[model samples]
Target: MAHIKSRKHPAARRLNCSAAVALAFIALPGAIHAQQTKPASAKAATEATLPEVNVQGQAQSYKSDQVSSPKFTQPLVDTPQTISIIKKEVFQEQGATTLTDALRNTPGVTMLIGEGGNSSARGNISMRGFDTAGSIFVDGMRDLGNFPRDIYNTEQIEVIKGPSGSEYGRGAPSGTVNMSSKTPFAGNLNAGSLSAGTDKQKRATVDLNRKLNESSAFRINAMAQDSGIPGRDVAKNKGWALAPSFAFGLNTPTRIFLNLEHIEQRNRPDFGVPTVGLPGYYNAALAAKGIVPPSKVNPKNFYGSTSDFENVNGDMVTARIEHDIRPGTILRNTTRIAKVQHEWMATAPSGAVSDGSGSAAVARPDPNTWTANRSRQTKWQKNELITNQTNLTTEFKTGSIAHTLSTGVEFIYEKQLSKTIAGAGTMSPANLWNPNPSDPISGYALTPNGAQSKGDTMTVSLYAFDTLKLSEQWQLSGGVRFDRYSTENNNVMVDGVRTRLKSSDTLAGWKLGALYKPASNGSIYASVSTSQQPPGGSNFTLSATDTNINNPNLEPQKATNVEVGTKWDVLDNKLAVTAAVYRSENTNDLTTRGADPGQIIQYGKKRVSGVELGVVGNITNQWAVSAGLAKMNTKVVAGSATQTGSSLNWSPELTFTAWTTYKLASGLTIGGGARYVDGMVRSVSNTANAATTNMLNVPSYWVYDAVASYNVNQNLALRLNLYNLFDKEYVASLNNNGNRYTPGGARAALLTANLKF
Candidate 1:
């Protein structure tokens, strides 16, 4: 495993649609209003100003769409970096009911499997070549740890790539993803959806909004889903999530808002299709007859009534308050606390096929029986994270220039507890199968009875930033942050190998950025940032010779990045285009070597450079297109040459994605899109010419999708979605033993109906 460099990535959002798709269709109402209003009436209304655009879920002092004011929609062009946003409307339109499903089409983003049943392995969004676990943010606050993320209350997802120590605390060398929750509205917005699809998949979602008073409101949302895997091993997996939120505006220059969310997601991890081998990636000659890759395996299983995966549950509470000191200076504060617990287990063959390879040398049969062996993995994790942040903004006039200065500070604390139970056994080839109807595989148990290991760690951080307006056409921003993170753990091995580990790390990181708004709709900017990675307690596990190499005295990893970009608004805000090129270098990156008990060492350096182009908003009133292209080149600058120049695991060099929606008539619309990834090889060693003979390189491929919707009325609609239209064959998996390859699945379709009143 190569060093895991840090890079910022996109945040988890409820919707998958791009900004362009929403802007295109949203303009219909304004167009209709114009046609219905007479010239005289329009003139009177424009002069009198009926009312302001009430921005939902914001403090009273903050107005909506203030060109010179700070707002969530202020756009990434305002900063000297790369930014992209995915709104909630897109999610509903595309029927993206889950976080994982929604991220598939996000620009320059890739999902990385953590491998094994480790709760920390559930899901990760990677940028460049760095893991983004600690780089994720919810509602502009830190929620980082070893827990998986869910989108039960998210309204929109924002992606900021490159080093962002300016806004985020000690962060990722890659980038950050911000999850923004849906705010409360003053009016009534009652919307609900019911969806049913193949494999007994059923789901129901409802959102209720009500105005509590002239200046207060509340919104409650709940969702329940039960679904089965459709293909080969269709295991029954289901769960439910709930979110409730409220907002208030005080007449005495004060405001308060609260949001609570509880999520329980219990789904089976597709450990993978039984790998006997099927050509393309898996060696067909090695696979059992009629066995399909895990990707193609039907969700329904033929084995038994149980699944071989794990169970995950998460709970969170978020709150904020805002106060206006004067017309120009205002103070805003926010806090969030969340806890997540997970238990996962899986049964796999010792000789599995993964990473498009088939040597099977990493996994040999139990010496006694030249037959297959069985292995089991069990892991549990409990994590809690809390963040507190405050910001102050003021306006001043200098000569002919109007300057609005903003400053803020952030404090974060995170705690993580983890345990693991693992072992393997050799079985008589014949006894591997369930022979009797009375007894079926109920999943494997821990190898050593009562064998469990536990460890915990805590991290604390503090930081601040400032944004300056130099002139109406120019904005300059710069910020600095500092963090002090530490961890401690206790582990008792079943064989009396008791170990107590205590490790603490303290580091300071900062960034500088400048934005020049040459015009009202366009800007050019540049930024430089830094990030660090701490050594975990697990680093204590090492061989005698490797102990020195894995020195607990290991320092935090470091990375620096510089980027330049330009943003433009074309056709009067109907189209927004952004382009950026960046170069990042990592020093003392933490990477694993060898299998299972891989030695953790800071021994690799990498350089990554890439150019990305994104276009959002509408191309025309009736036709909208959202497209993005990312070309990244990665090289191991100071390590073994073999793995250096090769693209890192899960880092595809060329990525292309686009979605287009055309409004056919009044309330009818159709949309379709496709995503493609170029081929890349997975390297796991620090030596040049590191044995490619037995390695596997996933081939490039595309996944096509289409959707159609009919607006039955003002508040009701029907939508249908088709995924993998061609049933393309490709593997989107990564793991150890190199034995977890899955053939891309065949076509699948779903339908949903939404009702709003």
Candidate 2:
């Protein structure tokens, strides 16, 4: 008896009730694979075909064979660097929510938009070319501020790449981004989901787990979202999140885990769209002499200030413990505490003028009322962050060599309060070739002209790491870290005169690596690392000149990286490929001072050289794939030749990504993907300013996405997602002198209903 056929519709008798619990989980996995291939009778196949039990969990992939990093405990094809992982069912089948949509499945990762026009929930990525939003992390700790990140209790994200300074400590010479929460197991799982599409999207998510007794356990995850940001205009986004977890002695051997998290956000800020006569211009011979250019706006225009606003709040607490003290030795501990808050009010755009016989270019609101210019400005900010971390891990062996160890200590506290109000008012810029958004001008006000700045910081760090095998295909690893930082700053004026500054520093970082396997799924590696930063390395402010950070001849800003890599685990291991070639350098940097004129020196130097390729998991078993590629070359050999050979402002010298999925036997599943970048450089180079030349580019683009699912039973499921499928409008982010720009989100659709019990 084997009959399983069902595909009826009339809206499946008007679904609802959570699509009838997602059609019984899309019909219980095709009715349990048709009752395990029916024909197995013959008295149950003459009994006894048993005696083949091989269960070694964790291996179900769309890429991600293994990763639970606290700085590699092996398996990621044998980790030596260049990690990626995405999981969480590939951003829940691509209806991704935040973390820049799961970093678009990685390829030289990117995202930058938040030049303080506020609210993308902070964390403005841009890896490999630096600016790693302070290297992110959560679970592995450090999740400072700049808000906006939710993957509804994410269960995987990784990243890792270059430098990583001995596994974190003043990172970002291009690397870092962890995330990995979602715990409590001993299962009895419960899941939930609901979503709606288009610019008026709405979302809800929940995941609950329980199992009290026989070891103890509990888990909870929640999220809520309200959206709108298709073609921009009045851009909007709202958020909510909560996470709770607890576990005690699960599976015994002494264990404990606890977690708590809360997040909130309110947004309405999109300071994008405008780049004077666009299209790669480095003053194209001053636009062939006639100038002109500035008219086809409408990527859903909405030039700020409709009561601009952005607010975010976050909190976290974590604790972990493990103990075995025998049988292969084990002991682990983790601790975390976090707090964050941010506030904002923004309205920006100020550049563009030229309109007398050079034909056009008008953005006037006041430059004496039109020497041909456009204007708008308003800024206000507040930020606070607190962090703490503790770690210890262990493993042991001697004699035949084998070791794995980790030790950590960290603490950080940061505070910032800022306000900027210049010339107090200006608005009314339209007509760079016909414009009018109800043109009106005046010194628009949002208050806060109190000019103030306050900054505070404190940090303490100590770290150590080790790994070694030394046989059966050798292995070795190393790490070291130490830090001591301090800062205080205050500046206020608007007639309330005040100024203060202080600084302190101490730093060191290191790493080294080697590995070789040859077989057993292949591996080959080489590595070197170093990192350092001081002088308020990225905010925590400090300046009273003398070369900043309260001078004393300030110093610290060094980097070095050298890499070589390879990893393979073809078919039988279910895919997993990797490759790398690298060179990274910084050597101080902090130019100027070619003999005073504001003094500052650091013998400059910059370099980047790259090649990377990756692939992940399943090539069969219903197919699944993940892909990446990157190519790079950046230089500045000595420094200041207007950036010597250019290449660093949002660096992008090629990138690529790919994703795949397939499954069917009636339980349906489908997928598609694409992403490409290449075309960057829009600032940082001052050959005395020829508009910072290198042709001021940004171009290069490609995007595409699609997904489908059905499951109808076993617990219900249904999904559909599509994004920028064909409406590639381009320009996803830009800032750093090329006057704003953002764009990039034009086609959208989403529909989901999932339920599991």
Each model's total of backbone clashes: 34, 21
Cα error, candidate 1, residue 477 (Å):
1.6
Give one digit per residue, the lDDT tens place, for model 1 in 570-626.
554456677788998877755554554554556778887887777766656666666
TM-score of 2: 0.32
- Candidate 2, residue 276: how far the Cα is off, in Å: 12
Q: What lDDT is reached at residue 276 by model 2?
A: 54
State each model's CA lDDT, in order: 0.60, 0.69
Model 2 scores worst on lDDT over the 10 consecutive residues at 6-15
The lDDT of model 1 is: 0.60
Off by over 4 Å in 1: 1-74, 116-122, 144-149, 230-232, 250-252, 274-309, 349-374, 397-405, 422-460, 537-552, 590-603, 684-695, 742-745
Q: Which ten residues in a row have the lowest lDDT in candidate 1?
A: 58-67
lDDT of 2 at 732: 83
